[model samples]
Target: MLVAAAVCPCPPLLVPAVAAGAASELADARTACSDALAVLAASRPDRLVVIGPAEEGARGVHPAGAAGSFAGFGVDLTVRLGSGPGGERALPASLAVGAWLLDHTDWADAPIEGLGVGTELQPARCAEAGREIGASAERVALLVMGDGSACRTVKAPGYLDERAEGFDAAVGHALGTADPAALLALDPELAQALQAAGRAPWQVLAGAAEGTGLEGRLLYEDAPYGVGYFVAAWS
Candidate 1:
């Protein structure tokens, strides 16, 4: 069962190296993420599983030391999922960002592992995967990585969508309240249309937290660079 959880966005912009001039814009989000992780560590879970979005065929376990680099995004920064020796497989962007967060925070809470869930993954499958993770260890915690809608403004990456604001608001409510029903009820089709990368992973979180009675707290919420980013903690 899940003893704690930290939710954060997966944008490469979270990395100072990748964001460069725009890095300061996300300073608050970074702080919130750090605070959330601190709560997770305080829970003293025996295991941590990082869940994030990936390509359709990229769904699988990313063991400790899985390689991650921002070279594709024009940066030389590299990170590993854990302290293990490097692996040949390069993590997908979302997991890469998750790894970067761990490296940036110098996480030593618990042994860490990663799982990539496809963007269009069915809710049932995502829940099943989550159940497995929740059962994998005695006191499991999650570091869920993925971004909210990217259509918050006309200048957003996906451009303006009239429904974007409402979509993000509902998501924010679900997360801030730790409403598993609301999370599981999120419409996949609508999420895909709005370019919400967090849909699948968020559902996984819902599955893990179901019946666990973990209270949630919203630490930060913003749409910097036109992409909805959030940081929250549950324990």
Candidate 2:
């Protein structure tokens, strides 16, 4: 069996909207996550894991309650990081979305696991985990959440400056700003590097709200600040 995992960064504010926006733009993200999960589940792999930040803070990580599950989607169980705070045990928004997907799908009754540890969201650690999980499964897909900057920070070998530039450009276009050139003036070196990486800024920007099919303006208008960097990848 092949197992696939997708990771996405999520802020705390969107938690309430999972059920509230069952039919809105937020549903786009939900569908994307569920699609990935369904793919993994269909592969019938040994395990399918989804990684993300803690919802409340960045101290620890944990899984969501049983109320969350994705039925027909390809998830047998969900393992979440514990709370990042002192002693609070809460899952991150990314993982919460995963759990919620599982709950909403046919696999709602599937077993969900929680893995809590005090660790930083570094690339080495995440990659290491990805490798470990991959080793055990016949086939693996990893969807990393977050944009170039966030992914670069966590994934190590930081993203090339070119990628960052592309992201900035996309952001500028999405924002309808006439002078994204100012970004170049502010961070010339970074801009040059992003340009060199050959990264697709528009793709990174689009990925955030890819499944939603909503225009960038509408999604960005409602998304919380700093949420744009959240990304997902499969390996």
Candidate 3:
């Protein structure tokens, strides 16, 4: 099974300014989150699920052991969108990388899950947690990070209800069909404050999914500031 889904709206503010020194903005968000986690550990996926949006109803899955050596890429699930205690914080860096993978790995004995977050955009808890981990998995890849009004307010309202001009073709067909890469590590004064708060929909869904097959790439590196990385592969 190979799955890598990453979405970011904040929380990699250069890893809390490199643990709070702000050395040149933590060396440009640690060189763009180490080149997007070295292209997500070069597509070596065993299990790494991280969904977004959380403020109070914090939900976190287990197994966070070897994130360094990539020991089986453990860290099953953690989906806490919003709506219970508080909401609207969208993707706070996916809850600061799910609280830095539950305070630096070990998954807390693994196996912890929950889902809610509903009010406007209803992905129904991210498509029922992506079809319950894609029905026992063999291949699953979904890296979604807020934009386009946090993915058209979280989709699922019978697909395309929010209708922000078809929110990037409805979030590239509900974050599937693979082939999406949009990296813009803002720094030019936060990319002119996100183009004066236009909130570029990841460059308009990577230029309308280009050739139409839905493979897109846009990396404007100023260095990984507010962190964004999505790598998925399943076999």
Candidate 4:
């Protein structure tokens, strides 16, 4: 069962080096993420699983010490999920961001692992995957990484979509309240249309938290660079 969970955006921009001169733009998000991670540490979980959306080839399990690089984003930084023997396979971008966050927090409370879910993964499969994770350890903690709508403005990666704001709002509310049913109820097709990458990962979190009685607090919600980024903590 999940002892705690932290939800955060997966944008590479969260890394100061990746963001370069604009790093300050995400200062609040970074602080919120820090606080969320603190919550995870406080739970004293036996295991930590980092879940994030990924491309087809990147989907699957990433072991502790799995390597991730920001070099692709023009940064020389490299991160590991946690200290252990490294893996041959590279982590997906989303998991890489998750790894970066873990490194930033110097997380040492539990053994860490990562799962990269495809953006198009069905809700059922996502939930099933989450259930498996929840059962993997006596006290599990999750660091979920993915972005909300990417079309809040014309400058957004997917460009402006009229439905973006409403979609993000609903997601924010659901996360803030730790409403698994509401998260599971998100329309996949609509989410895809709005370019909401968080849909699948958030649903996975919902599945893992079932019967855990966790309550959530929304730490941050914003549309920066036209993409919705959120940070929430459940405990």
Which candidate tops lDDT?
4
- Model 3 scores a TM of 0.24
Mark the 10 consecutive residues where model 1 has the least summed lDDT: 101-110
Instruction: Return the lDDT, model 2, position 56.
Output: 31
Worst 10 residues of 4 by lDDT: 101-110
Per-model tally of clashing residue pairs: 0, 56, 17, 0
Candidate 1, residues 152-220, lDDT tens digits: the string is: 999999999988889899989999999888998989999999999999999999989888999999999
**Best to worst by TM-score, what's the order?**
4, 1, 2, 3
TM-scores of all candidate predictions against the true structure: 0.96, 0.45, 0.24, 0.98
> What global local distance difference test value does model 4 have?
0.92
Clashing pairs in 1: none
Backbone clashes in model 1 = 0
Worst 10 residues of 2 by lDDT: 196-205
Which candidate number maximizes TM-score? 4
Q: Candidates' lDDT values, in order?
A: 0.88, 0.35, 0.32, 0.92
Task: State the TM-score for model 1.
Answer: 0.96
lDDT of 4 by residue, 1-235 (tens): 8999999999999999999999999999999999999999888999999999988777888888999999999999898999888678899999999988888885665899999888888999888888888998899999999899999999999999999999999999999999988999999999999889999999999999988889999999999999999999999
Estimate, for each residue in 129-164, the C-alpha lDDT of model 2 and write its tens digit. Answer: 434544644543333332323222323344323354
lDDT of 3 at 53: 41
